[model samples]
Target: MSVSVMAATAASTTVGTPWINITIFGAFVAITLVVVLRASRNNKTAADYYAAGRSFTGPQNGTAIAGDYLSAASFLGICGAIAINGYDGFLYSIGFLVAWLVALLLVAELMRNTGKFTMADVLSFRLKQGPVRVAAATTTLAVCFFYLLAQMAGAGGLVSLLLGINDKVGQSLVVAVVGAIMVLYVLVGGMKGTTWVQIIKAVLLIAGAFVMTIWVLAIHGFNFSTLLGAAAEAGGAAVLNPGLQYGLTDLSRLDFISLALALVLGTAGLPHVLMRFYTVPTAREARRSVVWAIWLIGLFYLFTLVLGYGAGALIGADRIKAAPGGVNSAAPLLAFELGGPVLLGIISAVAFATILAVVAGLTITAAASFSHDVYASVIKKGKAAPGSEVKVARITVVVIGIFAILGGIGVQGQNVAFLVALAFAVAASANLPTILYSLFWRRFSTRGALWSMYGGLGSAIILIAFSPVVSGTETSMIQGVDFHWFPLSNPGIISIPLGFLLGWLGTITSRTLENPAVAAEMEVRSLTGHGAEGATDH
Candidate 1:
């Protein structure tokens, strides 16, 4: 068949019924509600709500980490990428795994040792709380909102495609469902509930992907080479090699680099992920949790490669493009094709689980930052008791959920993968450098940390606003906004460095004013996890 005819034929295949999808999705929601309700009783204390009461063991924490990290971008986006873009898409898996290594080796233990709740807790180790809190909260809210937008967008796309709803309606529904479940989880179940939900989701996602991978290969005559050859023949050279779509050369290469930076550096900086470390009681447990998380992440990402390539070979690019919602539908669509109706139904349920699980995690994290960092620490000066803190967190979860739904409904047509990358760039730029320097750099002062956070945050936001994806500009948004200002789609290339530069300059300019006695106590607390109160210079 001619490629055009093959594409048309592939596009015309009927998917499963909308009612079937909605029924399955409804069941998933019921399960989450039950879990959240059961967990909420234990969430009375702020520690319980914000950090799961520091109760999870290493392995449980590891699973939750996997659940938290494996967002829609990993499941839907990567598979779609693989189906449409070929092996180049698998590169994301590599970048994510490499990033965890940094997390495990560098930040995990230190974060657990120093900070009580948010990234700001760590950066404010020696600084006056006022400037650090303001900067940290600004970065946290911005990062969470940007990241939530992508997840919300993904949830909308997933629901719309699977259930055949209008995109805006689908997004709104997704936002509401996710927001409700997460609010309950944080309000009732708190940290413990969120952790378990994450663990369960990780297991479901891995099992579902494994089942789909097997079916995909079986349909391809169980031959790996045949799969690649078929994918190549089907997609042409663009699919076979790392072509322009993979961003291997020139402009595309820059885009690729930006994505890599976001995935690698951004993981460590995310408030949600950092907060998970605090859930572990001790620094050693935190370290072990990350070690296991890296392995799980590696294994799951590996399966995505098969799912992506398998879809490419069996389902074809034309069909994926013509899918209800572009390439994001490739995995589910492929499931139906390979395993027929039963498998389609099962995979549809799994996809719903993926969305709910990811959204729950994101909402809880955002809530924690709002309540713990902004509300309790900055506004109340950490005066609230653990019980009151938990109550506040629950309320914030509901409020944040509403905002997420609104944002999700508003940006229904946006590319979630692109949004996720922007989140990463912002986190890496605004949060990571400050935390790292504060922990290890003795010369770093309050002024230095404050300046770094502001500089990084400003650069990332400005760069992203002008980015092609957000600005709707025809120019390579990074390249077109005047090369003199920003040169990459992701701002880590510029913003991260700028953060460090500002911090260094701020410290040097104010070296005489630096307080030695306060610095020593901050160092001890940050490195030892000894003092939760009275370390504040605020």
Candidate 2:
């Protein structure tokens, strides 16, 4: 009754056509459109557009945060990795789950109490608004750009595979449709619509995973050891070990550590994730939301472990490798093999919803950075009309969505999980240091914040551009060219230290002028929520 035994017995069964998947996916799209239309009715002010008027209860915001954090990269990419690399793929899940501890303990309440709408609000609270806002906005866009590239590429591949379209034109069309829908979500529903979408997706995603895991276990007579043993047999003995994919040699070990560092530290710096804290009504609510998010996210990842190992056990690595996107198609194929067309269609729809919800969240955060942080705070000196700011945010969403479509089409076939790791590296290098110093160091100055943001941002981009991922490897975009100069694909180890060093250098070398009064006020507000944004119902 093990999945492998079942797969062997049922190998000759005919699978259903792509039209079933299309029908399910279309239904999801229709539901999302209705959600956005309903949410748009209340998006009249800046607060409503950017922070959902700070009215979400703790549990609601927590589910939204889970939806935002568990992107296509997490649901599909991580599962794919596990199907291919076995135990090594589970390492990414562990890193991601552990990072939430940092967010829950250090950042959740602090960010909620100090910031109004964006990460810039917290960083610029005790620093110079103009320079700090500019630097923070720059980093936010940078993180979102790389993150969107990965999600959109995954979106295109998923759409193409599920719809049985094998051509580049078909993939491009899928990206366009996804981009347009994401734009609609942000421009019309704003945070309220996006949050609801995320909540619904999170529920569906978790429920889907739970059902799949139970089905997998039932096939194995509810024996965990039987499942693990079968997976090892299908994937070979190396699949159960650490060095199969990421941790082979000295250099690879260093790279693995660097990737772990980025994943652990980067969550705290992610602007979209940080912005979720502001949607709740109070600092206490924000704290509770993080706890709720931690539980939900942890449960989902546990289910992912079962899905991954079961896929490897049931689908076989050779067959998974021969699929369209190789291991990326493992989970979908497993669903087909297990429950035929119906479960496959459901899983495909969930994957599509995952991409849409994540991209919408990223779009809103990037738009908020441009409008709330840069336009309203920097260009207008905080005097921009609320209506005008919201209008600018809507326009920015369209622009960002268009750019993401082009980028996704351009980077098709790339490993989405790798690209996501790069995005995390940039966030860790550029944003985390600035956030930590801005919150903790009394001597942290505007000059330090700027150097931390720019230095980290510059180093991450430069290193990634020269790394083997771009050109040296067979899996790279331009595989024939070998112009890679950077040894490690992830730049976290070097760039993170450099960010801290530059911040210290800038602070000590610059003028000794310090704003003790503002620091004191920020500290008081962050701890007590005395002057933080209030709930809309209040």
Pull out the clashing pairs in model 2. none
Query: What is the RMSD of candidate 1?
Result: 3.3
TM-score of each: 0.91, 0.95
lDDT for 340 (candidate 1): 63
CA-lDDT, candidates in order: 0.74, 0.86
Instruction: Compute the lDDT of residue 172 as modeled in candidate 2.
Output: 88
Q: Model 1, range 118-154, lDDT digits (tens) per residue? A: 7777787667776687788788878888888777767
Tens digit of per-residue lDDT, candidate 2, span 22-48: 898889888987997898788888889
Clashing pairs in 1: 39-189, 40-188, 40-189, 46-386, 52-191
